[model samples]
Target: MLDFRMDTFLAVCQYMNYTRAAEALNITQPAVSQHIRWLEEQYEAPLFTYANKRLSLTREGELLRSMALTVKHDEQMLRRRLHDPGPGAHRLVFGVTPTVGMSLIPEPLARYHRLYPDAPISIRVSNTESLCAALDQGELDFAIVEGYFCKSDYDSLLYRREPYLAVCGAEYQFEREPKVLSDLLGETLVVREPGSGNREIIRRALSRENRAVEDFRSVIQVSDMNVLKKLLLLGCGVGFLYQAAAQPQLGQGLLRAIPLEDFQESHDITFLWRKGSVFAQRYRQLFELLSPQDIEGESCAAGD
Candidate 1:
């Protein structure tokens, strides 16, 4: 349980207006002011400042707001879990990024459902940042995220390494043999939105070669991978995507994976959960069910 004062502080930080925060809290403006003053006195730092009739958080206020939000979210999770144990309900909330959702999750999810027909699985797909934030705040039981290399307080395991490939329409022609990263400069490149792990990887890969995507003749940004694939199939541009994501299309003769000389780096995909959670046990069960050998191998062998 968090102090009610922290709630007031968070509301004020959100609205940045005393009157608005008071109204939201159903309290008097003076009371809001007093709460702010009390918090400031306790912390020995002013939380906000006023300049030219505009309100803004001071550095200390920003720090406090971030901490408060995490605390509030944790409290909410605790309350919800205590009130609704979710045991025997046979439901699990799994969070994932778009890339993982497209390429990796479906097969494992199908197998899990078949093995435990009574269990209902809920999936939340977003960018990597949002998924990680949700996991940290306890809003998700577990998550499969890419590019999480540093060890944190959470329990995690490296599930797979996704190799990247440069793909283009089958009909597209290139003057070079696709042996070097510099050969891609004049081609139109399609990319995901900023803040995405895929985008960051692409940026870093380019930067390390002393090159930049901006040097390309044209750049297109789209949030939907399907649309980007369509564009690539139509010979509109070249794009970078995980090999697993492009494998089916490559086999179907819709796209070609351009080989880059000496580019062998890969991104890590990890499964994450709260530290010391009972949910961790159940999550591991789910993980084993989704393991590539257990699920994908069996499926492939059956198909053959």
Candidate 2:
């Protein structure tokens, strides 16, 4: 179990503000400072710094946070395993981004449930950023995410790659055979909210074309994937998202992929757990049990 000082340090990491951390911990600001100072002295490294008038974790601080979180998960998981009724019990608390949650995972998850009827699995579906934060807080055991993350912090597996598509309503006519990204800048861009995997993918794709989302005529930010799809169907704007998310509409002839010049690309959907996790082997075994076999050639693990 983590000690009292580590708890204070984690509170500071969560808020990045001493006063806020103190309030959250129900301690005086001076107490928070003393705890942090003690930690710095114990670790023999500075944990935080003020940059541009904002508090940020130092390199040492980030390392400590990662290690502390990993230890916290292991400690909690050990207790859960000790009390668990079944042998070789796996405490499954997993997270997934909405892009993966929409289409790729449900069938495989159901099959796993059928096989391991006793396993108490909980699934958290949220945006990539929220999922990553939860994982750091030891709230998740593993996550399948589709957005950018600090690779050095996690052990990852390449689940599969999915086609990324730029799409529009079938009835929405382009002024020309839009051959490149620049041609569509006049159309209002419909995007997932900031910090969402789909939006980050869109940002990366746009950057490759020497453009950004802001270059669009206007922008519509939607948090709900369903609402975002609906907006696209109404010809309100063009959308960039995973093919799986748009597959139903495309199959129904309600949406069409916008053809881009020589732009056939796919994006990685990855399985991630904290690096050096005590349950790393169990997580991989679970992955082997749940991975969809149809998608080819990406079963190997990679640091990226």
Candidate 3:
């Protein structure tokens, strides 16, 4: 069993408030303080600092937190190994963002199912932040996320790099060679909500140019890319989307991909699995099926 004090320290680090941590642990505030004090005494250094009623981890605290996560993961793995039914069946849980879930996952998942018909599969569709957190918490066997790199402890490989395109109804008109960034300020922008990896990418790109999302005249905040595409087809507003995702609408002349002078960049879609996970082989097989060459040569070839 892991040390109880270490568990308390981990909880405190997560919540960043001793009172809140105590409440979460169903213990008294003084008990939380006592655990921290005991841990500090054992380590011979302060783990955190409190100032102005705000708490921040000390350098040592950050290191300890990382170590605690590793310990927790290892403990969980041990428990699973001891309790798991031997060679019967297994379920794999995959996490994905909505955009990738819609555009990229179907074919590979279908292939995986055909190949491993006995293995059960579960999927969780969420924003990138939630997907990453789920991966950390050991709730997912692997995840496919957009625009973010996996942490050092996890093994991550770039699965796809798809171009982001400015999309709008085919009827939308623009001046001859209009400035992409400047002209977008006047248009009604339809964008994903904050915390989405797509939105984060846009935020970072705009930040480089000393601009922000508020600078745009946004008309809608959508949660799903498919819904956004539907709205764009209805001539509601312009939005940014992965070229592969917008290809169908583009083919039907329901929407057009506007050429952006400086916004011609690709969003890297990454496949992530926990370091030293037992399901690594299954994840690798799935990744090979999802590899760009395989996917591009398969049913979605024309779309790509």
Candidate 4:
């Protein structure tokens, strides 16, 4: 179990206000202060500083916050397994970015479900940033994300390297062979919403040409992957997405991939779990179910 003092400290860190933390913890404000003072004395370092009427973690406080998070997760995991162990006793909660959720994870999740029909599963699909936040809060067991994140915070495995492609309606006629960013910039561009992995990937790729998404002639931001694909198919705009995601339309002669000189690159789809998770080894079988090589190899075969 996490220490009550540590929990009190975390509440303060979260709210950054002594009164608010106290109210949330159902404790008195002075008691909250006492707990913090005790913690500071034990650690022999001030954990927070009040400057300009704002509370902020000092460098030492930041270190303690990190350690506290790990300790909290360890305690939660221990309590969960201890309280619930036996047939059909565990609930697995995980997260995924929209791109991975739509294209890569369905089959493996289904297989896992079949194998452990009694173990309830909860999946949260959101942007990479949101997914990582949930993992940080210990709301998820793990997450599968695309684009880039702070890999140092978790234990991760590269599940797949998926290529991003420039796509358009099959009937849309290009003025010229698409060779550069300029060729596509004049057309309306459909892109993922901010914080989405696909949008982040496109943003970084555009920076190589000293451009940004705002440089496009017109931009359409769609939060749902299905809606984005629908817009592209209806010729609402040219879009960027994983090649495997566009495969179905490309095969049906309803969509065509426009080759880009600079944006032709792949990003990693990674599986992330809390660092030093007690359940890490226990969940290895889940990783085996979502193997990137196996998933993509089969996708390629189907495409061929």
Q: Give the candidate number with the greatest TM-score.
A: 2
Query: What are the lDDT scores of the predictions, listed in order?
Result: 0.75, 0.85, 0.75, 0.80
lDDT of 4 by residue, 107-226 (tens): 877777787777767899999888877776777777888867775467777777788888999888766777877778888899988888889988888888788999888999988999
> Could you arrange the candidates by lDDT from highest to lowest?
2, 4, 3, 1
What is the per-residue lDDT of model 2 for residues 72-133, given as tens digits with 9 covering 90 to 100? 87776677678787784555778988877878888898898778778788899888888888
lDDT per residue as tens, model 1, 150-235: 34335676656678888899999887767777788888999887757777788888999788778888999888778888899999
Superior by TM-score: candidate 3 or candidate 4: 3
In candidate 1, stretches whose alpha carbon ends up further than 4 angstroms from where it belongs are: 8-86, 136-138, 147-155, 274-285, 294-304
Name the runs in model 4 displaced over 4 angstroms. 11-34, 49-56, 74-85, 88-90, 292-304
Q: Where does the lowest 10-residue lDDT sum fall in candidate 1?
A: 295-304
Model 1 local distance difference test score: 0.75
The segments of candidate 3 whose C-alpha lies over 4 angstroms from its true place after superposition are 42-45, 73-90, 149-153, 174-177, 275-286, 289-304
User: Would you list the clashing residue pairs of candidate 4?
Assistant: none
Model 1: number of backbone collisions: 0
Clashing pairs in 1: none
TM-score of each: 0.73, 0.91, 0.85, 0.84
